[model samples]
Target: MIPPAALAIHLSIGQVYAFSVFNLPLSQIIGVTVSAPADWKLTTIGWIFSIAIVFLGLSAAVFGKWLERVGPRKAMFVAALCFSGGFFVSALGVHLHQIWIVYLGYGVLGGIGLGIGYISPVSTLIKWFPDRPGMATGMAIMGFGGGAMIGSPLAVALLDYFSSPISVGVSETFLVMGAIYFSLLMFGVVTVRIPPEGWKPENFVPSSKPGKLITSNHVDADTALKTPQFWLLWVILCVNVTAGIGVLGQASPMIQEMFEGVITAEAAAGFVGLLSLFNLIGRFFWSSLSDKIGRKTVYAIYFGLGLLMYALIPSLGRLDTAILFVIGFGIIMSMYGGGFATIPAYLRDLFGTYQVGAIHGRLLTAWSTAGILGPVLVNYIREIQINAGVDKAEAYTVTMYIMAGLLLIGLVCNYLVKEVDAKHQLFKEKKREGL
Candidate 1:
């Protein structure tokens, strides 16, 4: 029930990743007159998603402690309101043909919903299933990935139904999605509950590891920030996200350009959906594996194995084997999703559960940063090369190689991660003193 509540919230908020589905129609939306130039460009429209992501990081960082204090029910309710309201407001923005309004509505408001909603259920779930933290969180986070699977196609289908010669279809879709998400999230608010303080699941024996692989101590977000471990993990997340996001942001364009006539618009949408499915599956598969192999090893595979996979993508594209290319990227997408699901457990290992939610919130700043950097890098680099007369098929090669390099940096950061210092174990000391 708890996991499902979390999933209800996550599945709705996860629709943000599918925002790219609107990129084409939104950019070419017929405004005041069919003859008038488009009010927004692809680059300008890109900021809508970027701004929302920035707010997701910001709201999570700023309000994470508040979420802890208020608990999941209230937090999820607030998130539900803001997220659904953001869409309605954005719909108005579209009706009026005002980009700034859309930015304010969806980007800022919806983003706050995203951030709050994202972390709302994390800590509670961790507490409920201490013995299976990896699998527990993985189940909920998988919904985030799965949300995109549902959202991408759902948005496309809605657009087709609502769009006509007179309508661009974006505004109506926003209105509909907003209402649906609000209802689903409200259900989460109703269903979610916090366990009694100090409660542990029955038959679960706590690990008595000698070292810091698992800790009985807790660290607040502030102290966690003061440690080197947090920053290293932040770097790992940032670069890992950068590599995956670069591909996701440009999935449609990248595929069509690489394969041209071989890959149709429908096929590109299917490819995006395929990646989302893999993303959903990898969360459960990889994070559950972490229970046996440990979190650090899981991330090592994410970065090291990820590096080699990224390197293989460009060559696959050159070979013109669509199936092989999809398979390669599928592996990459799974690791991308795995990275998100595994990190909470990793945080538990390094920081303890005292303020793990807040710490996780602060750590999400890496995601906000990557959200902007990834798309900008891929799009900007490709644009420059195209202007230089590079072939469309070859434009992404440089981007792929750059992503591989970013993964290498992530590998280095992962290697540097160690347990937090004993000095930071204030909670452990407090427990000993019976304070």
Candidate 2:
């Protein structure tokens, strides 16, 4: 059996979740390179996040079947290599002052790592913890959310020690981070394995299927895609992701500008780091809570509370960073992290574990889409402000309002989610809700 510690390690090192931490510095580096009569917009840099997500989602969709065929450990090893290697190569790009190289290493190569690593621990965790699929997936996946909390502060320190005006100090930072992540991930690879068969959690049985005839058999990705549940869930994931990412994409500038009175630009880095902490904590706390609260209800809270939080941001003054940062950024980060955790269970609920690994691959298209929408919206709105001569804080207030609207729509989607096979009430008939 895979050691639980190994499973946690496998999931923790995936860079897709933690990559947002690089947005600010990466953007600044790119901004520095722009020449006279040329400009770099916030949206331009935001593309790094979008490109990485797009590639991550795309790789997941393309590689799902292969991953299923090969197994998570082998795939995750590749993930570690690519993720770490990408960072190393990216460090080179930064040192040479080559933006395209940075994009190639960080966006393309790292994206491949992100996609593979993303689904790495999921199936193994589900197989090992059959009785508590949501909790299991959450535990493994929560690491993604937490990575930035660890990565950002660490990256900041590295940059501080190595930073130069001409060169961002991104190289040394990448070298250290790449080494650490690779070593940790290798340890996870050595320890990961599948649980023994027929090993259901004591007294565990899955809920019944709702419709056309739920069977205890596995379904392939193509067949799984035909179900309404698949498409509906695609919508659900897209909306959820869109809501959180808009805020997260611009978190640093937003906070500094929002509370400029109390919080200054220099302090903004720490506050941004703090947002990551909330992001990380929310992943573990909310995902664990979903074990008791039910995925649906937890998401309901994610959206319901999220709407209020986004609405309050612009009005929240810099009176107390402790108060505003905790309340305002906390809900936003949870939604970001929760989207990663809750969706796996949502997929299991609709598609069954038959070919869930593959179906999840397909479903990640939603992430690709959200990646574009979220960063684009943030950057586009900010671009309008920069052109109109608006300051950065004032720039994002409009985006926040738009995100609130999107969350409300996501709230509707959550509301629309009746039990998957509602008409048939398949859950009523079956005892084992196949993890």
Candidate 3:
């Protein structure tokens, strides 16, 4: 049985990815405390997001062993509280116009919730659907990628309803969002579960070592740190993310800029809606596809195709309704979400499930790095271009070119990867070897 509890974890953890919806609102409110939106710089707002992600990765890694020891049930119960509470407190912060409080509540506390909530489902799902680990994970992680699809539109509606001319009033919006998310997460906490021990699916046995793993068997956190494969995968993830998230972080503004006079404000919001829609759909679409093609090959396609698309963005140069930008960019955004959904299976394939949840946690540091690098790079490049008097349409041209180069480098890395050898599986040999 897949377990009802697992499903809830899927829904709850998935909400973390929806934070992008708050950017404009946060920017509007935060700009007051900091300065004007244009003067405040998106990079400054991006820092709050970066802080949360850094904590998200750190908590996940530091607590991976604790989660392994205690199991997801208790951990997730606490996650519901912290995650929900973070929103409520942030609501207070926003209302008060206290940027630090917003950072503390949403960035720090909510980030902890994000990290723990994110890993909450992996081990349980792995146990329940051992035969189809990739697909099983895809189901849960697919939600994470697509969360913004539902959240974006829903938030916009709520924002539209709640919003007044009073600088997007942080407090009331916080109260509303916090209440709903709190209730929803409570439902998830009630639903999550752990698998029966020593249970394996009928007629199922994982390959002694999957052919695609970077290193065979379970590498301890210590040994995993020492391996070349770990760093290679690390670099691969960094470049991969740097290519996509830079654009995604700027997605709303980017669309607005792309559409300019051609599309109205409502239409640009709709385009952001569409990008998120594609982002959500791609999560399920690409990760599910990876099950057939193998993760490495799927990632190879992500970067290989991503490079070409990014290069073309400069030439496309703001089309009618920004449709061209939307289509091209939306596809790559899905790859970003797909990367998160697929990596757990990738870790399982190489490092073995014996300690995969832990390994996956360590791997998340790459996301933390991306959280910082992506926004900074995008915002910094924009600042430079604006200062140099480049037109809005042309401002992002060099960034597209830089992202293209990054993806091509990632393409080479993905191609270079081969399965980890048995020799590397020396630690916990009995567990991974299944003796």
Task: Tell me how many clashing residue pairs each candidate has.
Answer: 0, 13, 4
TM-score of model 2 (CA atoms): 0.80
- Pick out the ten consecutive residues of candidate 1 with the lowest summed lDDT: 30-39
Predicted candidate 3 versus true structure: per-residue lDDT over 55-138, tens digit per residue: 889988887777877777677766777777777888887777677777888778878877887787787787677666777787
C-alpha TM-scores of all predictions? 0.92, 0.80, 0.84
Task: List lDDT for all candidates, in order.
Answer: 0.88, 0.71, 0.72
lDDT tens digits, residue span 12-46, model 1: 99999888888888876775224247568877888
The candidate with the higher lDDT, 2 or 3, is 3
**Superposed Cα RMSD, model 2:** 5.2
Model 3 clashing-pair count: 4
Question: RMSD, each candidate, Å?
Answer: 2.5, 5.2, 4.1
* Candidate with the larger TM-score of 2 and 3: 3
Predicted structure 3, TM vs. truth = 0.84
Query: Ten-residue segment with the worst summed lDDT in candidate 2?
Result: 423-432
